[model samples]
Target: MVEALDLALGGVAVGILAWGFERYRTRFVKSDLIIAGALAVGLLIFVVLPGVYDSIGAALNIDGRFVLLSMLAQFVLLAIILHLLSMVRETNARFSDLVRNISADQAPQMDGGERTIFVVIPAYNEGKTITSVVKSLPDTIRGYTLQPVVVSDGSVDDTAENARYNGTVVVEHLVNQGQGGALKTGFQIALEQEADIVVTMDGDGQHPAEELERLVSPVIDDEADYVMGSRYKGENKTGNGVVRESGIRSFTWLINALTKSEITDCTNGFRAIRASGLEDMKLTEERFSAPELIIEARKNGLRIQEIPITIEERQAGETKKPQLMYAIGLTRAILATWIR
Candidate 1:
């Protein structure tokens, strides 16, 4: 007869399998069905014929009891982990949407004349430079009207105030959401205004306003839907040190290998994207989202191109993240973006 523990675990397996089937009729995938089915079958077999693992264990030169326990622990742990991860991801998505909705309402009314190009600058705690960055943008990018929108990601400083004083559109986050979150807010606001193109520039004064036309030109000319400004292809006058430079190259190579595309700079914050094409990608990273954009842009069938751009050192404020944490966060973003 089967033990109590066997019946208890077997019932759970059966329930999960039933749920998987119900989901399959709707949104469940093949992988989910396979895993659920395997668990149910394995548990049922173990309950009905407990000695079945003995011969398998003998062939493997291990104790059957140990094999049974190991499988039991691993299966339960894996199931719980996967379920928790799904819940967390779903929660994060909902929260991000709500935040964007509340914050993006501050987007100034667009006059809806000529080709509207929104220059989105995501800043955090850069009060000393926010006004300067806003004032530095040209009145037009390749003859199209330019609107500057700044997203202050939970800055305790005067970032939002500075942008507002300069009469620039400011989306203020109530809490810190990292660079990725700020970009998402800015993108949503720009799209709501029926923008023709969205150009993202760093608010730290590192990205020159003169190069804005270079990034936006391809989209304006109908040459490419997505254009990434590559520092490697041009000049990195700031000199990001040897170690950081090596790390950037290493990560770029890995991302290129995974994506089957040669991207010179996967971490550049400067890019130009056609408004319609930008709406198709759903970015979820909270930090270091450059890699995510590259992966998603290629995946979404956008005409991706990289152009040479000059980058300078930050004029004010300190780097928000430490070197070690930056590397770890970037790796996490890459893996999450690539797999998800």
Candidate 2:
């Protein structure tokens, strides 16, 4: 009866492994699947052929049950560690790519002398909305020539093509880095072009192009080194429900308390900064870049101001970020930036 129960449990474990393998095969790399398959096959052999398992245990002078349990624990632990290591490796590779891409070449210069307004739009798979967003941008903002730099963060769709079609200079990542990484790449290019003021807006149509002047006015007028757009203070329209709104308010309170600044909106991405002010700032948050930038800017004693602006609904496609996950990430980013 005991032997039968052990076999039954092993069978259930194998069944679960098989189900997982089938369900997530497409999501995993070929090498990872191969390793998982090999482990499953070995476990199956040890469970089905107890005599072979005993023979191996006897050779090692250990009980077969003990040997089996030890091997199982070791295999599970090794798989977890391997998975974590793979994540680290991938992250490191992406960081290396970001550095390489940023230093590769300077973007094409704008005509009519030195470009004064550099707009950096960071996009993931925003193919559908990118063209419209780029096209709607004014050729000039407040008498300064507008130069749009679109950083495609490893988009698998037609995002890069659409930006190019709209005549914006494009920089692309070979792998998907989060919004923050894309912005860093775009900012570097903007600075390289010797732009007086660098403005950042989402590639999604949520940020109105007509508001571009308002967003950058503080920087251009030399009133503030960094200008952050505030949805609460302006004509704002958000589709986010109660839970998200509450979370935003809580985060805003925490940021204000820590930074000793009264910011109405903490996560708005539509903002502008003087190119010179960014020289000493070190921004490292790839996912929570907006908050990180605010924290870093405040820390460096840069003049920060918030301007009222309108935020419209996204043009197309679902938001890539899950609400719960985004909240957690933003919280983590806020804490990380504060502690750092």
| Range of the 10 consecutive residues with the lowest summed lDDT in candidate 2 | 97-106
Query: What is candidate 1's lDDT per residue for 126-180, written digit by digit as tens?
Result: 9998888889888876678888999999889999888875457888988888889
TM-scores across all candidates? 0.80, 0.72
- In model 2, how many backbone clashes occur? 0
Model 1, residue 55: distance off in Å is 8.9
Candidate 1 ranges with C-alpha deviation above 4 Å? 1-71
**Which residues of candidate 2, in runs, are more than 4 Å off?**
1-106, 109-115
The collision pairs in model 1 are: none
Residue 203 of model 1, lDDT score: 88
Query: Residue 296 lDDT in model 2?
Result: 90
